[model samples]
Target chain A: MKLVNSTLAALRAVRVNKLRSALTMLGIVLGVSSVTVMMAVGGGASQRIQTEMRNLGANTIVLNSGALKSAGVSKGQGSRPSVTLADAQAIENEVPAVTATSPQHNFAGMQLIYGNANWSTLVTGTTPEYLTIRNWAVSRGRAFDREDVIQGSKVVVLGRTVAEQLFGNQSPVGQEIRVNRVPMTVIGELAAKGQSLAGVDTDDTAVIPISTALNRVVGRNPANPRAISGVIIKVRDGANMASAFSDIRQVVRERHGLLPAQEDDFHLINLTEVMRAKEDSARALGILLAAIASVSLLVGGIGIMNIMLVSVTERIREIGLRLAVGARRSDILGQFLVEATILSLIGGIAGVVLGLGGAVAVERYADLGVVLNGQLSLVAMAFAAGVGIFFGFYPAWKASLLQPVEALRSD
Target chain B: MALVAVSDLTKTYMLGQTAVPALRGISLAIDRGEFVAVMGSSGSGKSTLMNLLGCLDAPSSGTYHLAGQDVLRLSSNKLAAVRNTSVGFVFQQFNLLARATALENVELPMVYAGIGWRERTRRAREVLAQVGLSDREHHRPSQLSGGQQQRVAIARALVNQPLLLLADEPTGALDSVTSDEIMATLVRLNEGGLTVIVVTHDAEVARYARRVIHFKDGRVVSDDLNQNIRAAA
Candidate 1:
């Protein structure tokens, strides 16, 4: 039989039970739509995280002093010795692979006073290299220079949030603000940095040179004078990060006088490793969503098969009439297969539209980065059509194999 | 030469391992352009024999030649081809597709024969006109009267111009007046050189045929020329 004729006949058959056909196709629509929407949302979240990670400086590495409780009782159970200015200088001088190094000393709940106005904020003390390692660019004013650090000048750089809170629209550059009863001149304002996924406010802190912060503002404790919170390092190139990390570890152990068998009291956090972990978690989440959506597709396929079987049973007499008119088994098969495929194709088209609409709405209204990728939509559509073919075959085959005489005899 | 030759044709059913014979060694020959009727009471195997001759079922054991081709030797595809091009069937229930118009129902066989839509439609209209259904071509089976539906079935059967027309109790569901109308249509086609076979228990319906074959207990008890009946008709 001509394919066009058979397809028309199949269409006529489906049209006879319009409500039933639509109900059957509803399952496929839901299945494909859910798959598309979930993929969009999941893919969007991973892309957002990657963008944040890139903005945080791809080559940056964080080093923190590990607690000495597990090392031995003689070392005392207090916070481990901080990474110092000398240690930062040693890494910069001895490690050729190290591009820049900065020691960070953070003080929380610090009150900043500017004449009659005072606001509480976080205070961070570091060298000029801190801006490069952290990927922060000065937005409004110039950053503090090495001259300010050497002279132990009481100078500071305000983050966007701190500047806005204290000075409003007025420029705070070269203006003096007091910190813990010590006055300091603001030399720059950091750029506007958004909050991280971990909910940390990046633009609510103040940056000051480490020398002035330790000696002039927050005086170093007599028991731990040379103490610093942690060290931030930037590598010349990522290709040599592993080698540079081992060299830095050796130098730190030697300077601290730790034996070969002793466990190092410092922890290194490679940003590259953190980025990879985030990517792996995102990938796992995507797979889980895909798997759950696939269950809906499976259920939809089964629904199609079930409805097709009922259709076959209901149309036995019609099948008999066609067979009597000289229809081959393949002709019957083609007719039913065409009906099934049309149902799935219609459902797939509807799903694509609905899924894209859903993604766009969520992205706009909920502030998510959801986006419908074209390739994924195509794959989902193809999979839905394949499901129709796979599940539609058995019922169609059963209809084709029916004996004409017996079918005609059926009431 | 005979258009249909059947010898020692037997068919049996196995109902849970009990062999029940429907037909036992039935031999018959039908010449081209002949109008023959097979008459029997219920359970007399007349319908079984009709089903075999119509190519709707295969005999358990038999050598049946249709148009000089060994019907038993044909493959399923060949058999389907033979059924498509060589045989037309009319059933008691009219068997017209309920969803199709009268013209579309008649065009169905040509669709199976791989005819193009234009030619199928043309031939279907011509046949519908021949059966006096030209004005009702657009009507579905449910919209037509019993007699009209039967005529549509006859038009469908004749669309392929088959070598034989097999009618099984074709008028069983119609009233006497409608039955007469349907029989007259069949008689006119048979007179126009189409071989016709009618299987029925109605003696009055059998009178229209040129010959009569009677069956009892799965075997033919009498086969005779109906000269008186034919002369009267």
Candidate 2:
């Protein structure tokens, strides 16, 4: 009936059975640790997702020129080049959220010759904004400017991997390389971006002015000189991307004079959607792992109940004495319940410390990202208390229901 | 009204398929501040009657009153409350919580009665001193002698200021010297206006009671008031 008394009594009870109580709490400690660790892993995974999103450019959208249709029969990607340079310009001018747009044309498996040795890689042609839109920095020299792009200068920016292949340890800047019989000066080198989400080596390429590609190689198609391979657009921060996408599509559709009855010649790729799906699945996995880990706490609670029941049986005479001296049934129940709660609570606290230590250790030693979810420790504690309540009740109730006279009669 | 009233009490218990009758038509009354002893051999129903009188149990059929309340029809919870508020009990075993000090043991009944810690400690100290255990207030049951543990139990019983002290074979585990000391404490408590009833088989122990009721075969064989009640000294 008195809370302080019950707590003090519970403390004394736990102290009497110190080893047994600690052993019972070990299960609960494990349960809480599993939950905390799982959540931390989930949190770490979320951080990795953020980095992946950054790598993929969360605000960038790619409108690739493809999905060409002839007599209602659709040709595959890049078969038609309706996404011209003019359409890219129109998207920038008409779409309010379009911060920047870079029209690109690329020839895959192009041979580059420097002296007698030669290397083969993709050659992309684009303006300076291409590097900004793709989050790539120029490692040496400078990015191509408007003069280089507009003057149709025969200059190239080599990706790190391509530079290594063509020039070896030498600085590729100020050097000239022949791209299948057409000579170009290497003005800069792009930084390494490592592996992309598709596990492709993004650095194994080269960049030239778009004017050079249109004028020299892959000169013309059915869409004429204005046609490009694709347009990469950077949407401003805080802009509604979905509406920007629609606005860009509308501008392109109108620029190409496609009617409502016809599908546009290009498809838009919102990179954020892919990143979000990855994040969603990671979150779901976190919850699932935590749920799975929580089952062990119930088992731990069962351990508590088992010990409590044995305790009740062993302390029958004690119970009888308490009852004989004016303790009510609820008093007996409260005492036992308090004991169980204290046991599990100790486990919960230990588990929190263990989980945090494990998280840091995993992150540091395993070289994996680990995040600490502050709420999870609290949740695990509450969970431990819940286990105490759910499992402790029956045994306490059993103790309370004991007949004082019979209990006193027991040895 | 007398401190206790009983008319026509009977108790029957079922053990598996057998109906065992423990108490049959037993009725008795004792006044406030009386020191009485109930005596019988095992299975003679003196223990059963003690349980009923202490509010630890209810009779199968009876009209019983304690301190002006008809307790025969009271629910288990109310019966427990009655035991808490009005009746205190001592056992043959000292029944002290082995983990708790003497003061904490004495404070337990008041704990269940929802007494605050400060007041519980205050009154428990007062009662422990009354039982001549003031110096042993912080001693655990294991740290005390057998007679000292029994005194601590008595101190616990008196903590609630109950109307009756029902002791079942209170000195059964103690030697004669220690038993006399325990009886002397009970007599002193009785002299201070606390009603005390002891159940004992030893005639030497029963000699200290002012009135003795003897039971045989679930019936009272004799009820006698002794003029030369033996003093503990």
Report the Cα RMSD per candidate.
5.5, 8.0
Across B1-233, the per-residue lDDT of candidate 2 in tens digits comes to: 78988888998989999999999888898899899999999899988998889876668887899988998778877887888879988878878888889999999888878888899999999998888899999999989999999999998888889999999899999998999999999998999999999999998889999999999988899999977799867
Top candidate (DockQ): 1
lDDT of 1 by residue, B1-233 (tens): 89999999999978998999999999999999999999999889998898889888889998999999998898777877877889999999999888789999999889889998899999999999998988998999999999999999999888999999999999999998888888899889988999999999999899998899999989999999987663322
Error in Å for residue A279 of model 2: 7.8
For each candidate in turn, the TM-score is 0.77, 0.69
Model 1, position A410: C-alpha lDDT score: 72
The TM-score measured for candidate 2 stands at 0.69
A281, model 2: CA deviation in Å?
8.8
